[model samples]
Target: MSSAPVETVLVAGATGGTGRAVMRLAQSRVDTLRVLTRSSDAAADLRAAGADEVIVADLLNPEGLSAAVEGVDAVLSAVGTAPTAIPSGPPFVDGAGNRALVAAAADAGVDAFVMESAVGVGPEPSSPLATAFDAFIGPLQEAKAAAEAAIRDAPLRHTILRPGVLTNGSRTDLVTVADPGAKLWGVISRADVARLMLAAPTTPAAHNRTFEVVSKPRFPARNVSIDWTLP
Candidate 1:
């Protein structure tokens, strides 16, 4: 028999592009889908899109977020800047908002977390190709780096996907990223990224895994399975 499904999930930043995809995917598979949106109208859209519960809360408001996350099995975050958007504000959203959410999740007793970061951020990114990120993508890279630090170091069990260049495309469910061979870089579909993020907690290999993901394998119809052995 199949294991019991994760009944309820509270998705933060559900109105955004990748978040919307994750929400829809979760709703289709999980028993209940709950979303947190700043705008009532956007919450309505999420509900119309089949969200079972829409909680209106600002990411900046910890109490409000704590209230929203209550009684959920897990939390999935796809929060990020828009394609045409680069935030130039103080009290950075990616860093501060993620920290707040971590606390809120703890308070709400939601342990499993699936979050997104980028492919390169560490002091020495291990891969030579990642060197290019230092100058061009500092803002987002730094913010995501800080948020990832919070997630990795937090008390909760987390799986953070540091995806390569994201594009809206077909989700082949064939993406790969790990140590040694995978430390290099490439691109992945946003849809596939969402699918992997939503599927993280369900896979035992995914627990406490902070890996990068890229394009599909060259071989098709073989049923790709990524080995999570640390290099």
Candidate 2:
């Protein structure tokens, strides 16, 4: 399938780590960087951080998302819940919120969807490290797995990136991307993930693909090379 360049992109969870990195980095790359946030107060700062427009909406409630995704070429979701929030209850953002977003994006005619998922959230024989990580996070990984399934079933073209441990380290641009079942285990910076998410929509190789991403110089799995430049 052919993928077209994104002139306007809507970023969900623009206040989170990877989302912030995307907001900071996407300023010069895209014609318009739109952000969706739950807080109306975040609008000014998001604008200052290079967001051309800010739509205040919560993903858990799907009603307002049609407006949130309207007129955007692509949707990039970095939404996730912290481990501490696991005990609180259902309606976990990782699964429910993202599923809602996927539906809304498809409804609004968004061309592509990019999701930041965690490793071990898809398929069988998950690596030991990923298994342990999932166990530590309780139901979060399961929620992400469901979200991944929702994306796959949706009509829109999608790219799901399952990153190992995420850190606040710098963007090295040396990332190792592989199929989900690869023996991939390591950490990657939020900045690097942001770079790839922004690039995925326009990169034909990344369309309708799911990848496991990790920082380079670690892990023995064969890496998948993708042209990360925005067209």
Candidate 3:
């Protein structure tokens, strides 16, 4: 029997915590996995982790992004600057940088674009944690909001995942997904987020959707369900 067709996925910010997890998971699922980064320092490591190609590209530099997204069936972006860091913070990386990537993906004829956003980025905060974080990284949240708008306006199919506070915990394989305004909040492992990103392209419920996610432990008891899917 013929095997299922494999996708060519381009992962931006492949050196980040979530990005690394995504690349690791994509190794076995994707036909060709390309990682985009600003430096070559991690090239060898990424290759060892299963990246078919590592391209040097800075999200701040739009001219280099075209080559990064080229020839990929899907694009998964986990790009964002440190909240405390200035200059290269939200405005540049999350706002303008992500906008550029969305445009590039549309131009490249990429089938899908999956983005890792954060909670409290929409009109309001869903939890106290999001409210507190937003107080410090308001600009970053604003930038992410703008980036989401750009992705929505883009022609290609898109799935934007707004995960709650991230932790180094193990994957629970149980995720709580709700609409953007839903009060879903709590910490989740970067690995779980990566897994969701991996499934986004093929999951029908994720198409053209923007959802907030948290692990099972954090999900409200009344709403908990093993069959909950991204919508």
Best by lDDT: 2
- Which regions of candidate 3 fall more than 4 Å away from where they truly are? 1-6, 87-90, 220-231
Worst 10 residues of 3 by lDDT: 222-231
Clash counts for all predictions? 0, 0, 0
Query: Any residue pairs clashing in model 2, and if so which?
Result: none
- For model 2, how does the per-residue alpha-carbon lDDT over 153-206 read when each residue is reduced to its tens digit? 999899999998999999999889998788688899999999999989988899
Residue 32 in candidate 1, Cα distance off native in Å: 1.1
Show model 1 residue runs off by greater than 4 Å. Answer: 1-5, 83-87, 124-129, 216-231
TM-scores vs. true structure, each candidate:
0.85, 0.96, 0.90
Candidate no. 3 TM-score: 0.90
In model 2, the Cα lDDT at residue 218 comes to 61
Candidate 2 segments exceeding 4 Å error? none
RMSD of each: 4.5, 1.3, 3.6
Model 2 global lDDT (CA atoms, 0 to 1): 0.89
For 108-223, candidate 3 gives per-residue lDDT tens digits of: 98888999999888885377767876887888888889999999999978889999888777877777877766777688899999988877877766778888888855555423
Candidate 1 C-alpha lDDT tens digits along 1-231: 112246788887787767877876777677888998878878667889889999988776666887777887778988775423454553555667777888888777786787877777655344554556545666767777788888877777788887777888877767665642255466788888888878777766777767767774322322236542211
